[model samples]
Target: MALLRDMTLGQYIPGESFVHRLDPRTKIIVTMLLIILLFLVETFQGYGLIALFIGGLILLARLSPRFVLRGIRPMLVIILFTLVLHVFLSEGEIIGQLGPLKVTKEGLFKGGMMVTRLLLLIIGASLLTLTTSPIALTDGIEAILSPGKRFGLPAHELAMMMTIALRFIPTLLEEMDKITKAQMARGADFETGNIVQRAKSLLPLLVPLFVSAFRRADELAVAMEARCYRGGEGRTKMKQLLFTGRDYAVISLTLTFAVIVGSLF
Candidate 1:
């Protein structure tokens, strides 16, 4: 349950900070640019620059560093697995040994760099959901995809689907946690077995979770129908999206930073 609560990727925190006030489109674009930069950079110095940039954004947003970083807890297993695989499997000068496995200097460097990249990517993406509301995120994504409407794209539907998936992440996690606890109270053992056994133990939990998710979906659909909800055709937004001067300035600065970082170390 604690682990589920620590998951913040799909959660939003309301605030009046500069980052929270930026146009959703601006935040979305900057996040994409940062993710692109993360993949493009190789050197530690470049990663350091990106880290600083993200840290600055966190400060500007006035978000708790602990709260922001808690989002990484659920992904720790994947991160560690990547590090272990790289260390044991990558060929290079052997730096150490564990039983039959050899650890190489190159492997260590590569693993550390990969882990750093993953962390930065996670944090950068989390910031988007942390600061932007679901409605605004949907609006921004739809607007970005609107250009494709000429090619028969269902922009609004696509955006809504993406947003809903993200929005439901925490809800589903909480539901799973609750079901796990309930099953455990009824003498179900989920943590006392090997990988295969533990997975099998989850069968009971998954059954209830799926039923709950389907029920919620049905309820939401009925509620939407009750409200006379339709697709985006001829629909209008109550709060129109407008890019202010601050948005332009931020976008320009982000692009300039990306170019400079790409050209430099």
Candidate 2:
């Protein structure tokens, strides 16, 4: 339950910081570039540089470091599994032994690097949502995709769907948490068995969750219809988005830093 509440992926924290003030389009493009840079990064030094960059962003955003990182808690199991898999399966110079399994230096390095990459990726993405509002994010996405409208692309519709999906993530998680607690109160056991048993235990949870999700979707559709919410065909935004000098400077600096880090390390 605490884990669900800790998730900050789709939740926005209102602030008057530099990051929060940037044009959403600039932030979106920078985030995409950072993601691409992550894939190109192959050295610890490069990762370190990227980490510093992200840390600077966090500072500029005036966000709590602990809050920004709390989202990683839910992913710890998967990250640990990845590390263990790499350590035991990858063949290299043996460093130690755990029973019949051998630990290798190369494996340790690869696993650590992979874990760092994942952490940075998550933090970068989280920062984007934390600083930008849902409406702004939708506008940024729609604007970026608008050029494709010539090819019959429904840019506005796609952007709206994406934003709504992100917005619902936390809502769904909270719903799941409530359902779990309710089931536990009724003597349901979700944590007492082997992997297979535990999975089977979730059957009851999934059924109700799905039903709830569908119900919410139906309700949302009805609400939108009631409000006469049409697609972007004749839509005009209440708040216009325009890039400023700060946005251009941030974008330029980010690109330059990414290029240098990619080339140097």
Which prediction has the highest TM-score against the true structure?
Answer: 1
Best-fitting candidate, scored by lDDT? 1
lDDT digits (tens) for residues 111-214 of candidate 2? 99889999999999999999999889889989989999999999988988987897798799888889999999999999898999999999889999999999
Q: How close to the true structure is residue 40 of candidate 1, measured as C-alpha lDDT?
A: 90
RMSD of 1: 2.8
lDDT of 2 at 4: 49
RMSD of each: 2.8, 3.0
lDDT by residue for model 1 (220-262), tens: 8898779877887878889899999999999999999999998
Candidate 1: clashing pairs of residues: none
The 0-to-1 C-alpha lDDT of every candidate, in the order given, reads 0.92, 0.91
Q: Report the C-alpha displacement of residue 242, candidate 1, in angstroms.
A: 1.5
Predicted structure 2, TM vs. truth: 0.83
Q: Could you tell me which residue pairs clash in candidate 2?
A: none
